[model samples]
Target: MKRFFMLAFLVGLIVSGFAFKVIMVTDIGGLGDGSFMDGTWAGIVKAAEEYGLEYEVIQSKEQSDYIPNLSKAAEEADVVFAVGFLMSDAFFKVAQQYPATYFVGIDFSFPEEKNLPNVMTFTFKEQEGSFLTGYLAAGMTRTGKVAILGGIPIPPVQRYVIGFEAGVKAYNQIHKTNIKVKSVYANTFTDPKKGKEFGQALISEGYDIIQQACGGTALGLLEAIKEENQKRANIDNLPEFIDDLYKNGGVFMLGGDIEQEWQAPGHILASAIKRVDVASYLGVVKAYTGEWEPGNVELGIKEKGEGISRMPFTKGLVSNKLLAEIVYIQNLVGIGKIKIPSTEEELKAFWLKGIEIPF
Candidate 1:
């Protein structure tokens, strides 16, 4: 009996040894925000099922949790993925200690360092997707006025804003339209109060649709839009806080970084998605399967790694003619026929072409 028990134990150990171990440390927003971390988790779960990998996830409650989480994962995991730009410093510190364990940093870039051979930094061309959203907003707006709200001026955030404005100008010039756009920077990524405040301010200024580029701040923007809905039912004069001097119905919000259309259903028109899931998934698969490559991997509209999502909420809401035009543009942009502007000069030239907004 003793000999049989020992043999069974040995067989179990052998089976467990085949499982690849992965540990993930998520951003401050944690698992339930229905955004990047959630998307990454979905992909990880798929990999876990397919590859028989043992995996664990740790949520960072604050920025301070980053380094500790990284260190913990490095000690146990064959490969560890650190999500978000907020964790960059933490990752750098942990990487120095765990020189043997592989590290994947999503939405981050690092100076080339041969000594940190185990660290792979992945950054996305979010502006590419933002450009599509901007073009669509320009084409669809009926008020001849649109706006953008950015959480902060970080390179990633700034790129989205720049690219979006450029796309708007491109479509406007092609159609010979003049649509005014107002942009505001909230200067903070996590505060919903500032997002909502800026959103209300934009609406009062005659901006009808505002694209929000902050994380939690975007959620606040949505809240402000909802408040606009409540106010529109009451009076012609909008509050000073929400000084919109024009347009009849409530204002709308567009989300960035993730598929945020579901956040407020009808309130959020579309989302410029950065495919954090695909990025995370690819990283895990590469590491697990021995296909991992160092250096930068950029995903954009051309690569199908990022794009805007216009789900059914827009059906019947946007005019058929406008929808058709957007579809045509989408195909063109996707196929490289319509080169969406990625620079300030490119955007200005596109708008100079004078393509007008449908509204």
Candidate 2:
């Protein structure tokens, strides 16, 4: 994943936001790749239009570029947005160096008792949203096998993995069916070739559904799915609906960080929606109004920060009944009746305690 350089973009913000300067430093995925970075940039773009703000984007090509990109942004920006959890360490270093600059870190985690006067970070309950995708994958798989693919084995990515597996297990417990889940990691977010290779191999191995949590690496996985679907499409009657697709050996993918359902359409069942855009937009609002404070905020389903998306691409193809079940589970999670796990111990306890089906 790589972000391309862009000329500074200006849009009309709200009255208070009209005079602010904002800059965003993308994670390794950069922009596009149909995931997280895209969502972050969308927030900046939206804030610009709604608040009359001037913004610039600095795309980090690799891990080493984080400090430099952040440093460059803080030099001029009234507020600097560090757009990934991977940049947490680098973000803090930059924030300290430029104490006058206010910094907002999206998907940033705060280590124990670590707070800065000039920094605020937003962390999402990615596990909660990811749980829904896991359930969807389990419910839709005809082959009884699904997979979770991550760009790296970091805690954030692990949260997605944990929640997904817990969801699949929850489904299995409720339905009395045995579904297998596999977790794979790319160790790097930038390699689409490796991602595509993993996708094809997993598909061949009979894991019919794969949930992609990786950033740009997922681009290759999507490409793999398209290729597989094409190979399978040369049949008498290709299935137009999800059930038909499942029955005909077609594969599905669920994604995270943004709406990637449109990336592969039918092949991509849905994406667990994380409102990184909302977090970014609000960060600017707070900074512009001088309400900015050093703190960590965790937004989840209850806060409208994370959830499953409405199936727009798959539309009529996805079953209404299945969609209902997903929403039911999502609502349960949103209401705190269904506590999805974010760690190994909790996931273990979750399975033992069982998921509550909100009918």
Candidate 3:
């Protein structure tokens, strides 16, 4: 009878051990940003479903709420995820306060001074994916003009622009085409009006393909493209406008961060996908399975953490030959054959290496 009771007690312990709890603390964008926040939440949900873990999220309405929300999540959950680079300071503070709990920071790189053992960070090589998008845009642009829209002048967003410019330069070098690339920063991630205004201005200036790295603000760019397409539908004999529209069924907009091909079917050229969901889900799984460790995890095309999406829409729009070239570039980057520029210094060095810039 004692043996039977001991076995039952051990079973109960095992069951309880499997029931891990996770909590995500979102940045000021909150849950409905339809870009970064939503993508991270999708990973959390996937982890919960796959591991049978309980999960909760605390959405911050403003910058001031970051610390409190992260602290609250750290206290309540076995593993806490502070989503977005904006919460890096708060996450570091909370992780230092609670050394016993595991903390994960998405899109964050920990400073060398604050190297906490219990804290892990996941950062993506967004430039690699953006490079592919720029390559595709250069190939698909009929007007020889492409543009990039950024949410803010942060490093992560800058990486996208830098890589995009490199890809365009590389394409121009190989094809002897003078493709012009323009970039703009909205200074806000949530303002769709600003996105629309900038997008419209670019469209009027004969920029046919616009790639957006802004968060929710990108939705406005898509809306502008749709509205412009409708306005020009009745205007005949406009070969320049017609050629731009014919290249990809309409003015092309490349998506960033998440798989946004579904956001606009034919209008979306491709998405530079940063797999935050994969990172978040894997982080939670590791914590739950006792494999969690402290360090920086940099995911890139090699690790399937970031790449371009080949959704049905993209497959239909992008040619097989171009897709093959994009894949080749992806593999080259993954294998260290192609070095993508991520910083200002590196970009300058790249340009100095006999790469022509169309400006």
Candidate 4:
């Protein structure tokens, strides 16, 4: 009996020694919304496969779940990732308690963390991508007006909006063109009905294109567009104008945070994608390897970490001249040819002064 006990103990020790455990805590949005959470999970899986590490994920039911899920993961795993900006407060609290365990906060910024070496924060300049997409929308609109539909007027969403406006203003200044935008926030992250209503209102106002930064709410906006398209079935070149006030007035949809090109093949011009997978995976790898540093890592078009992706569906739809112009604008932002605004104050200041990047 003594000999058998000793052998069992040895086996357990060896197994524990080799186990490289990691845990991921996702936001209330869940894993597979074809959005941010899914992108983060993709990176987690990649790291697990590449580094021979084991990972477990806890899906958050709401904001309240952030602390508990993170605490639970910290108890067992080598490192934990608190995904989403919504999890920032919870992550800070949990990290303070478990000073030894590593934490990575995606889109969560903390300049002062009580010197918590275990917590690392990551953010991206989504405005950069948003600006590029906004420029595209301006150039594509046959009419001088475009509309933006957003999930919520949160900081992140606001960043995209500010960037979009700045981009449009800069493009006009550069090319000496006349283009303007009408922006609205749906104010809810997942309300489809409101989204459709907002889209309808924009169409009624003679807006020719829309940039959708909303999540599930964007689905309704797209549905509204589809319904409008159906009514113009027999029309030539898809009716330049339709009688229905809710109909898409030659509107094009641009999505953010996910590649929504397939959601509407020809209608969705492009997508502004946040590479959450890469961010999450890097966090895991850092924690496991003992190189995890606590600080903010900001990504943008310059970093190739986030940007607007040209869709396969519209590969040939946008004219070559238009495509070249869009690319030029993107490259300008990427290489500092055009300095886009990041904050509300900066955006206001830039436009007020009519300042243009000399690039």
What TM-score goes with each of the models?
0.84, 0.90, 0.88, 0.85
User: Residue-wise lDDT of candidate 3 within 135-179, one digit each (tens)?
Assistant: 889998888999999987888889989988887877776677899
What is candidate 1's lDDT per residue for 1-359, written digit by digit as tens? 99999999999999887667888898775676556677777777788778888889998888878888888899889889888777877887898788787788888878665337777777777777877778778876767788888876776777788877876776666776888877679887677888888887888777878888777777788888877766665444334223332234446677777778777655677788888788777878888888877656777777777788865454445557766766666666677666655556765565323233344
The model with the greatest TM-score is: 2
lDDT of all predictions: 0.74, 0.83, 0.83, 0.77
Put down candidate 4 lDDT per residue, 109-146, tens digits, no spaces. Answer: 88573557787777888788788778777877778998
- Model 3 has an lDDT value of 0.83
Q: Give model 2's TM-score versus the native structure.
A: 0.90
lDDT of 2 by residue, 108-191 (tens): 767666678888899988898888889888988878999988988887788989988988998888778899999999887888
| Cα shift from native, residue 151, model 3 (Å) | 0.8
Q: Which of the predicted structures, 1 or 3, would earn the higher TM-score when compared with the native?
A: 3
The candidate with the higher lDDT, 1 or 4, is 4
Ranking of all candidate structures by their TM-score, best first: 2, 3, 4, 1
Superposition error at 102 for model 1 (Å)? 2.0
- Of the pair 2 and 4, which is ahead by lDDT? 2
